[model samples]
Target: MTTQANVDTRISEPDAAQISEFLRDHPDFFDTHQDLLAELRLPHSSGKAVSLIERQVQVLREQNETLKSRLLELVNVARENDRLSGRMHQMTLDLLAASSLVGMLDALEDHLRNEFKADVIALHLPGLSETQLHESGAENLVVNETLKELLPTPLCEGKPQCGRLKQQQLDFLFKDQAAAIESTAVIPIGHHGQGGLLAIGSREVNRFNPCMGTLFLSHLGELLSRMLQKHTAG
Candidate 1:
């Protein structure tokens, strides 16, 4: 009842699976019939017919390349972390060495510009009184009694915030540079912002984003908080 066409159709690909299973079950079969290795011709991307052994080697080479790339990426990241760590240490020394509020601000601005690559820096110490500001020689220090009210919800609760901010918030922090800034980071200095707050602006849109880790920012805030309290206290 089966013609040549039907016979050919009946010979499905399942027989190949059976053959593969048989080969796997009897590894010695390949030892007995070493001639099969020469019959396996795999087409490569370069349009060349390669032997089965060569194909396996090529695949392994590709996997090795992928692993190497990943390892290189991790090494680069580690190097960057080390660089950031060194910069942070220098900043700590600068802040500690500051004799007055003006000196502290100067240290902060210099490090931010040279080490952190920040486009604009805004330090807000709304807790300080006008007399304190005058005495500390911080006439240019940004102060806002209602700064907490103007912040985003998370920042209001003393969270580190990053990414694109609303125009009003940008204007509040960076004033002249607000329009030029494409991204910003808002780091809370202390509880209720009694110490102060820091706003770091960048011209690049992706420079500051919500997904970035806040560990460094948190450390920066804590260090600044101690210095601010020391310098601003009566």
Candidate 2:
């Protein structure tokens, strides 16, 4: 028994000579076996370590894919937001460009044509009454054929004249023949007695709704009416 005990101890412990010889023969053997030696030395009660590691790797891969999808969605949404913001900025710039009555009308027509896509735009101003005109000079005011038909006979009996019959009350009309006209907004221009009207037509029915306030168009109309009054007076 004593001999057997001595033999077991000799097998378990490396002699100094044997250790030196092994190290000289394979210098990297210890490095290569370091992790394996450590794992072998640990208690087996730690459970299925390989299975746990594989499950962790799978969970990490799934999380990475989810994160990648979320990042892509964010990028797409940001691009769309930038596009819409740019369009809104351009519209604001166009609205600010209106200065004179003719310019305002041109701008409005352009907006309707380009943005709202209207079919036709028309403007009408009532004729002067017979009593206001000098009988001798009245014949000159009745030349406008369409105006002659629309106005009362008394207003156009003598000369063809552009008549201002009332305070800031200008009649405007817009017709969309294609039934493609989706929406219309009649904005009265000017303050008190100085303004005319702005009629906007759109090809989309829901484009204009009663819920929308008249602030922007009303201000534009007032500016235009003031310019028109100045032009007429001058």
Model 1: pairs clashing at backbone N, Cα or C within 3 Å: none
Question: TM-score for model 1?
Answer: 0.74
Taking the tens digit of each residue's C-alpha lDDT, what string does model 2 give over 42-159? 2223554444335546679999999999999999878966764565355446545655435545665676566545544443322323532232111112224564354322224321
lDDT of 1 by residue, 1-234 (tens): 779998787776468779899878997986877797889899989999999889989999999999999999999989989999999999999999999877888898899988999998887666667776665433243434465567843346778889999999898778877999999998877764446678899999999999987888889998988998788778
The C-alpha stretches of model 1 lying farther than 4 A from their native spots are 1-35, 133-150, 153-158, 191-194
Best by lDDT: 1
| lDDT on C-alpha atoms for all candidate structures | 0.81, 0.48
Instruction: Give the runs in model 2 whose Cα sits over 4 Å from its true position.
Output: 1-104, 115-120, 126-172, 175-180, 192-194
